[model samples]
Target: MGETFTGASDPKTARIMAFGDLFKAASHRMLGFAGLAIALGGLGGLIVMLNAKPEERLLPDPDLTPGAVVDVSLEEMCEPGYAARVRSVDSSERKQAFRMYGLSNVDRRDYELDHLIPLSLGGSNDIKNIWPESRITKPWNAEVKDTLEDVLHREVCAGRERLGNAQWAIRTHWIQAYRMYVGSEPERFVAHSRPGF
Candidate 1:
């Protein structure tokens, strides 16, 4: 029965045999791919083992600490439309404007603080960081201007972190002022109303 079709197989039998061969070839290719994947994985593991330090390998990058405050500068705070206001402006205003209208420190400075990141945004209240500018200019200040960018670009930079302590302090003072003047709900206190670059 097997010898009967040895010389010339039927078309149906030939087709079936061809399909079986193709199936075997496909299975071999799949197994080859899996083996290659495993080999590459092992090689990668070996490479990592050879070069990686024990502390550096399993642990996250030590330099990459979380919640680190991004550094900003006062000169970087000033944009074309933005200007620093006198830090004293908040305390010096006439009673009519501050007491009656309930003006923000930035507003009292004519939106100068808005041209810079408000103390509310973790910015400082020093003269370098604070500026008195018009309300139209407030929209242009960068909320988080990078001093590093200026330095990297080799621009003439000034007063790095000079205002940080003052800024932080003034921000606290501003929060207190808001609570005193605006009766809390201090989120309504608008310091960053202007555009910053």
Candidate 2:
């Protein structure tokens, strides 16, 4: 006999009606709309903020080649003697001069100037010796750290030698060496040692 049609349809019939498919489509559309709305809101906010302020022209980027050192005289400009004198001022004077003038935290609170080579390593306290870094970062020690890591990499099947090659280009070409005057500690920004001065 045929199944009775007393409006007691099988529960499976409800799924077969494809209501789940319709719900999924609606949900996907709603999610897309939500994402678009959020992106538009962020873009609009950025535009408004930018428009509210007058645009200040930025100075041209300085030549960062090592030879550009001609612009700054090492001896006449950044002597440790001058830095020590600057550090001797009264507390209020420092706050007014350094903080008020936006030269905040531009002094070495720890660590002496590291000659790229220690005087023990034939590194003088000359401008080349001076790269302000944390006391923890001994100049030669930084090189040693890299050497040890390289050794580890060699032991580990010379994993990604190209990464090592690319590292030197970025370090020498992109990085700017700063005069090691009594400036702020070198900020190890991300994977780079950039002087915040």
Candidate 3:
């Protein structure tokens, strides 16, 4: 027959058994709370990542020359008719700029020889200002940039934004402006035209 023990008969053993049970319960609760904390932390990180603005991704143009100057003045280029005549470069010049940027074989149809600082904002026509902007890859393509150019042109002409500052803003980081105004990067090229050059 198995021995039937009572707390009164073996007080020390009873206390030891009770202590062990209590310890086990505490250990389980601690582990559960720790796991929950880790899970919540992971969820918080994912939420932050989802809510934050996407980083601006762009390919660097290796052919950009430092301190290259544009010969044209803002007043001359900012006029309504000036962009058509002044901003156009010859095919050989375009090809040369493309070659300098290591994009020799790229189809001209797929990219625009974009000015880092647009002519309307007094950006130079020099090779330093030109890069092969991808129509497919860039968040803000040539068409979108045309809109930005017009906006800046209006601001500059109206004396709302300084021409030098506008040029610098486009040259320094055009992507940030694109993100600010456009909200997000387009998944693909959106074809639309604005009135006036």
Candidates' C-alpha lDDT: 0.30, 0.28, 0.54
lDDT for position 24 in model 3 = 42
Per-prediction TM-score to the true structure, in the order listed: 0.18, 0.20, 0.57
Give the better candidate number (1 or 2) by lDDT: 1
The TM-score ranking, best first, is 3, 2, 1
lDDT of 1 by residue, 143-177 (tens): 21222112212221233223333232122222222
Tens-digit lDDT track for model 3 on 122-142?
Answer: 665667677777666544566
Native RMSD of candidate 2 (Å): 26.9
Model 3: lDDT equals 0.54
**Top of the candidates by TM-score:** 3
Model 2: residue 65 alpha-carbon error in angstroms: 11
Report the candidate with higher TM-score, 2 versus 3: 3
Better of 1 and 3 by lDDT: 3
lDDT of 2 by residue, 1-197 (tens): 11111121334223322433343354444445544655777757434432321101010011111111112222332333432332222445334433322234555454232222222111223332233323343332233333322222232222322222222221221111111111123233223222321
TM-score of candidate 1 relative to the true fold:
0.18
lDDT, candidate 2, at 173: 17
